[model samples]
Target: MLYSPFLVTLTLLTLLTASARAQQSGPVVATPQRPPVTEQDRTEAQKFVAEHHPELASLLSQLQKSRPAEFERALRELVPQTQAIQRSKERSPARYESQLAAWKIDSQIRVLMARWSRKQDPETETKVRELIAHRQQLRREQTQAEKQRLTEQLQKIDEQLQNLDQPETQRIQAEWEQLSRRATIAAKQATKQKTNTTGEKKTTAKKSSDQQPAAAQPSPGSR
Candidate 1:
């Protein structure tokens, strides 16, 4: 199967993200049971696939009717990663672009695997391997990028540490103290108000009870 250059790029980006995560977490462990996928998750997954991989959209729909289990599994895989990619787009566009391709590749690979599982064939296996290799290359690139990012961040942190004794530090410290004191005051006021409100409610309730007419006394020979 011919892969679009765009798909190839996206697949690599996803692999890079995965590599970075795996490095941080160390060895992979058994996955814990995931929460049941919701309708909202399915919708989001569908939207994501529709946008990134239009071809897979129909496949997903078909899976839902003919292979419900496979459809759910596909959703479970797609939702969280797609959500993360969406967040990255909002928080960091460059990062989003870097990871987007990788995500696409990963999603495509999953779909392929699902298909292959049902009916294994040499052609499908070859495509899977090719995609996997493409994704790994992306992972390596992503890891390098992550390292570079971390290096830059560390440099910034070091510069900040070196400038710790600057006059701005004192100003910042004073501001922090002022904020903390204000927060303390606000919290105390809130607590006091809540306590007063509760006491007032109790007092009002007691007064209403006191003002109530007493129950009528039983007649002496009513029994």
Candidate 2:
């Protein structure tokens, strides 16, 4: 059907968008769990989903007309997708476990992309963006331990330069430039997989805030 791809894309984007907007609260998931599917459960879910499916079909038009970011959180949680459904194969349990696994992976990738785009927290995002900007500044054989050693050296130089009567600013700057560029390269390859027309890199960041049970938030100033 002409609507199939649109539906799938809408549902996936909704699920991911909701996850990013949510502010995580307390100690929650050991691991996310799904309840076992009963026949009544399957019937109710299927009927409701089929009836409301057109809401999702209309999402893109709605998105274009509204502030998608603001509305995304409320919409994502309520939309049901095949990944969380309880369907019978010949009136038995799911016969498509592999499909389930693949669906999860696809959802995860999309969510990470949403997380990066929003720049929800600049401190964390700067780290992500810096990595993206500086990718390809290094070689493949480098190890984590090696990188740390270089970073430490630059840090010491940074500190010494701070205390200087006449700072060896040029020397310190050169050293930092070398290690930072390499780290930047490695970070980019590890993250970005696609690019938008705006030339911004796209990636997914998912959170199952609904499927994931929310931990109770602490009262303000009550640590």
Best by TM-score: 1
lDDT of 1 by residue, 1-223 (tens): 4344334333323332344355355676786887777888888878988999876676656556665655566567677778889999999998898799987776677657655655689998999999989988998998999999999999999997866757997869977999999999999999999999999999999999999999999998996
Give the alpha carbon lDDT tens digit for every residue of 84-188 in model 2: 433523343433443333333434434334454444666656664544333322212224535776899999999887766455786678778989999999888
Give the least accurate 10-residue stretch of model 2, judged by summed lDDT. Answer: 133-142
TM-score for predicted model 2 compared with the true structure? 0.21
- Error in Å for residue 106 of model 2: 2.1
Question: How far off is residue 12 in model 1, in Å?
Answer: 21
C-alpha lDDT of all candidate models, in order: 0.74, 0.47
State every prediction's TM-score relative to the real structure: 0.54, 0.21
C-alpha RMSD (angstroms) for model 1 = 11.1
Question: In model 1, where is the ten-residue run with the lowest total lDDT?
Answer: 8-17
User: Model 1 compared with the native: what TM-score?
Assistant: 0.54
User: Can you tell me which runs of candidate 2 are displaced by over 4 Å?
Assistant: 1-79, 88-94, 119-223
Candidate 1: where is the Cα deviation over 4 Å?
Answer: 1-38, 114-122, 165-223
